[model samples]
Target: MKAVETAPHEYMANYVYSNSGLGAWFGAARLVDATGSKRGSFRLNGETWRVTLSYQESGLAPPEGGETPDGTRVDFDTLREFRLNAVVDDEIGERKVKALIQPRWYGLESESGKSVARPMWELGDAVNVRVNASNVEFDTVETAIQRAAGAVTLDPMYFDDRNEEYSVVMDAARYVRLDRDVSGPVHAREGPIARMGHLLESDRSGYRKIVQDDTERVGYYHTVTLGPKRVRECFPDHRIPKEFKHYYARNAESLPDDHPLAHPKVEASYQGSRWDETLRPVDHDELADELEEAVLATINEAGLPTQPLDDDGLGGGRTYVEDAYFEAKTVDRSRVLPLNLERVESDQRNVVVRQLANGLSPVEWDSLKTLVADGGDVSPAEIADEHDWHPDSVRRGLRRIEDMVVREQGSVALRSHYVAEQVVEALDAAREGVRNAMGTAANAVQNAERRSLDERTDELIAFCQSNGIHIDEREAQLRVRMGNLTGESWSELVTRLKRFWTAAGRDPERLKESVTHYRDEAGPKIRQARGAWTGGQTLQ
Candidate 1:
């Protein structure tokens, strides 16, 4: 089934329709006779042919022995079928499958000499072409192609000398598949296809938009889609001016008499299916070569400037983070500090340092704090023993910010006095914030002890509601009655509440009522919870 060519070569050679996009659907229904249709009849060269549409479905194969002639496989779970039939007689009611059609792109050749002047013909209108035959014989294909080529041409969409709005899809001798992880510039400013940026980019594929000029209200827009095996360029929402349209269009009457379309041509000549990897070159070196030739020929015939991708498949400039990382791995490591710390603005530098500080484990932070306080180089073993941590834990913590620290022999020290000052300042501020928070919580717990049970219950309920932690009135009352607020510090109480909330799948982080922000909201609630916890009532 996979090997069968679904449609006859004669039908393809004789037909003057596209094998992809809207043309595929139209061609299948009409000349190829692959799709069913409303009962109708059309006359071509004195032969009246009746048309009908029928549909079928199959699993993992073509329906009723049908196959995809383009050599692409159907999806694993399903296959589609659309068959065309010709009604022979009304009285006898006999019908026959006219021919099977599998839409295979045959490039820009025509068995018939004619080309569609107005490509946007309505489906009903398109079926009423002046030429047709009992079968797709050479003379029949030629008549249809010639008559259509000789027919009236379409007016341009815009009444302007500049034909900026022309769209075409052409097959190229080469394919483009971008590798995102290969480092380099993803786009270039100067090229035939200029100012290109990717709408979507990934390791294996990308969709890039090329805007030729920014100032023009209406400018040429082009896109190149890259896949593992195929690269297709599309210029949509456009049309060539009448003077130049003849070259790209199927019609060849205006060309020199010796031109292929002007004389004899095979529709599938020099054509290879984009879907069939074996038929066409899988990878075009870059958008700069044959791929560019196809595009440049289409748009002032078009082109792009591209660089070789790096090992990662990401193109363009290396991110500063990656720069610092690569530098850090070197023996000299001279550029690592400036790349990370000196190049960015003050605020950004602080952000980078703060992120580094935040990434350290609590033990790491403690070790750093101790070192900062000591104001000297410290051994990992010494720091670990002071904090009752394993030596490896201390070393690991220091390594998280190793770029900012100098490790020589067995001792680790901040890389510079300035970096030491910054680390100390950041660490001190974080500790102060925590201390202030704990103080507020401790004060709230003390204050709750003075309030009546009813007053405390009201405060707890209001705090929960305001903070987005939902609790019913009954549950609040039960919590106040059951809980005791003795012995636990503010941090311990907050921990207990967070644990229960986490267990219940509620995020404590979303709570707006922080100890510092909602001074009155948390203290009493903490007290009520503590008392209720002792009384064995769960805080809902």
Candidate 2:
């Protein structure tokens, strides 16, 4: 059968052409009815001509054996094809053109099972093709198709939402290289899908969902490009909120048991128990209310402010109790004393008695009390003499009593100051007593010396009479010498008197001479006695 070609432009509109510089088509169309329609005339170099085209059988079939030939019509069983013939009359002789026109390309198939034609470009080799005015080298037609179909063009402003007025041109090749699934509807509005697309191109992990206008189907979502396998680790199932457990449980059931989202192992006993004996559920609100009530009760018992204190409240907004703080005062007669008066008196007496007993002997104690009672008029010396104690010991005992009184009474006793004053007065009186005793002792020593001297004088007088030395002046001279030799022995007194008499010319010879010279002037018997005493002769 022959079909005449008429509207070539109309026929070419229904098929997709390649950029291989080879005339071809890749899609199905009814071209037999389009051949006879008047569309336009062909013009070459300003020469006009009516173009007449027709087709005839080419009588070629696809190979049936080991390998198929290139450019073979494999879509049909019989390979019913045609040779296209074109004639154009000009000033030269008539010219004829011939070319084959098969029903379709050998391997191309449309969705409706119609044969299609495509450029016979090198299929398995690498080829450089232009897309968006830029050359892109692809290894195969499949790669080229994927590059064109999977490419997602986006405005740079979509990712940078902060700057609305800014615009940037992005290379589609860069996005295609990321291998993101960009087959969904990319809306220009600033929505999740748009953001997701932007994230995918930027090598980010994200997801998006959309509801069609007529369908209410939910729970469907798509995960967009995650940069790499490592990038998918960032979006793990554990990060999902626990509140979404119900939905996740449903989803998990659909997954394999080994999947991460699958339900974990549960204790069989726990699952079987309807009402657990060991565990009880508590209402948190009731517990909170009970705790609050207990706290308020405690606060009220403590006498503290229960409500929040205002700025002008008592204690200047500080929590405080009523009459809770106080200062302690020293104990005095003005304060109320305990009713046990006897016990108090006994304790005071015990302290004073213990101090007195520990510090003094019985005699010393009695004497000290007497001295205090006597208004300190009794001397320590008198007390020592009566007690057979040393006077210094008596004074020490009295001083001890004064110290004990001060220590036992502290500042409370009326005797404390008096005792201090008495101690000072006692020291003064004791010193005066010591001086008086020293003077009395000196007088007694002087008197004893005078008696000894008087005795020695009598002895000397008797010795002179016994020796027949009857010098009447001898007694007076001995008395004077004895007075000068006070505290000396009687023998020393006598020796000193002898030396005095010898130096005074009272020797035997000197006395006899003196007696003769004064015979007429002196008594004769006195001169004879003196002579006998000096000459070692007995008195007559």
Candidate 3:
């Protein structure tokens, strides 16, 4: 299969979703020590896990029709006592943390000469709307009882949003974070295509709101920080801080389209495009195997694609034949992105030229200008000789120039494909004959007259037992290393050989004959089985 290309970055859920927080899962946790009135911020991965509980005092029971996605039976009374687990920390900047719910569409390519818009969505409607929440809290003053051993990760981000789609509270509570620790079980619906962040706590005390400023303070949206790539504040918090949203408040009138990121792109025409599609150059040894004498010899008539070559004509031709060649198209890797590199290098060179001017070094400029003219390939030694500068210093400048040039010239691979499969088969008979000869040499214990086999066997036993060994265990070890050796009674032969060595030796000549007998008996059978592995090649 051709390699799968990565989806665009916008489709990726960067690690740090908002407020430098690794988003948490809802309705997914277990208190290590469950006890009534035992409540505190359940720390997840050394970070605080926030739990939100709100209830109407007069409510005696949960409202009818209130059901968790998992069908977890609950009512208004149940919601009164809620527990949400969310990572909490100091989130500062122009806006509060929450998901920016913008309806997005992919594959909106233009055909003919017209344009089209894709679907849109409101954040948190289907998704957990967990809308970034404040860090976890404890109703009762107490420290976290159990230190979460591993990560407190959610089933993929969109999992909850997919669940409880048909439920009514989804719309009413479109922007509420779940108190999942107390939520119990929740089911996920797979049909919807949407995503949202939990509503995190606001700087203002008491009730918190979602951040949704599109224009002003958009830059304040959280950046994603994951892994070593330094994922920091990645997702845009839907909640907008009052002061920061002021910049774009007036501009919000022409939203969705007027949002800087939603600009219309005029795609260039693709008159006629061809790309390099070859996987890689083929191998040589694979082309060396012969097959006609092995499989075709059994054919008395034509095969499926056509009549098979007759047995009489099987072994007459050259070992192998391959005549077909392919036509491939490729991009000019050098020039396709030339301007990208040039612009980057120009910025760096301009800086170097300024440095030369600041020092008022006429000689330096002459040497540097000449080296620059040589492009990125110019050598450091050449620059040093031309500028009368030290080699080490010139080397550093050359490295900087090379880096600037490469950064300027972005590198991208040309994708391409080619098609073809050839017939390949090996003669197994030949392989077995070789194995038989090796086995015979190994069985000739009496041939070694100078040192007794029992002497060596004793030494082997001593070596293994010296390090704590049992007889059965040592025999099992020897059997494992036998790998792919051929013999109808190979296992029996090994047992007998070990036994004979433990006592007296056996005849060397008879051992040789046993080897010959094995090859003659199994060689042809092994050869016939080769096609069983590759499946007989059907010439079509």
In candidate 2 the C-alpha lDDT for residue 237 amounts to 18
What lDDT score is found at residue 467 in candidate 1?
39
Per-residue lDDT tens digits for candidate 3, residues 157-244, read 3222222221111000001111112111111111000000111121112222223333433322221101111001111211111100
What's the C-alpha lDDT at position 127 in model 2?
Answer: 14
Q: Write the per-residue lDDT of candidate 2 for residues 1-540, one digit (tens) a residue.
A: 111101000001011222221122111112322452112233333433332223333344433441233433334343333222222335432222222323322443344454333355233111111112111111111122222221211111111111111111111110100001111222122222222222222111222122222121121222222222211222221111000000122354466644433421100001102111111112212222222232232222223333433334333342311110111111112111111212222222222332322333555555644555554245666777777888777666655544233212211111322232232333344345533322322222232311012233334334432332223222212111111222543344334445544543344344333321111122222123233335433221
Candidate 1's C-alpha runs over 4 A off are 1-357, 434-540
lDDT agreement of model 3 with the native: 0.22
Higher-TM-score candidate among 1 and 3?
1
Residue 246 lDDT in model 1?
A: 9
Which ranges in model 3 have alpha carbons more than 4 Å from their true place? 1-39, 42-129, 133-540
What lDDT does model 2 reach? 0.27
Question: Residue 164: error of model 3 in Å?
Answer: 14
Candidate 1, residues 484-526, lDDT tens digits: the string is 3345443454555556544433434432122211123244333
Q: What is the C-alpha RMSD of each candidate to the true structure, in Å?
A: 25.1, 58.3, 33.0
Give per-residue lDDT, candidate 3, residue 22: 14
- The C-alpha lDDT values of all candidates are 0.32, 0.27, 0.22
What is the full ranking by lDDT, best candidate first? 1, 2, 3
Give the least accurate 10-residue stretch of model 3, judged by summed lDDT: 416-425
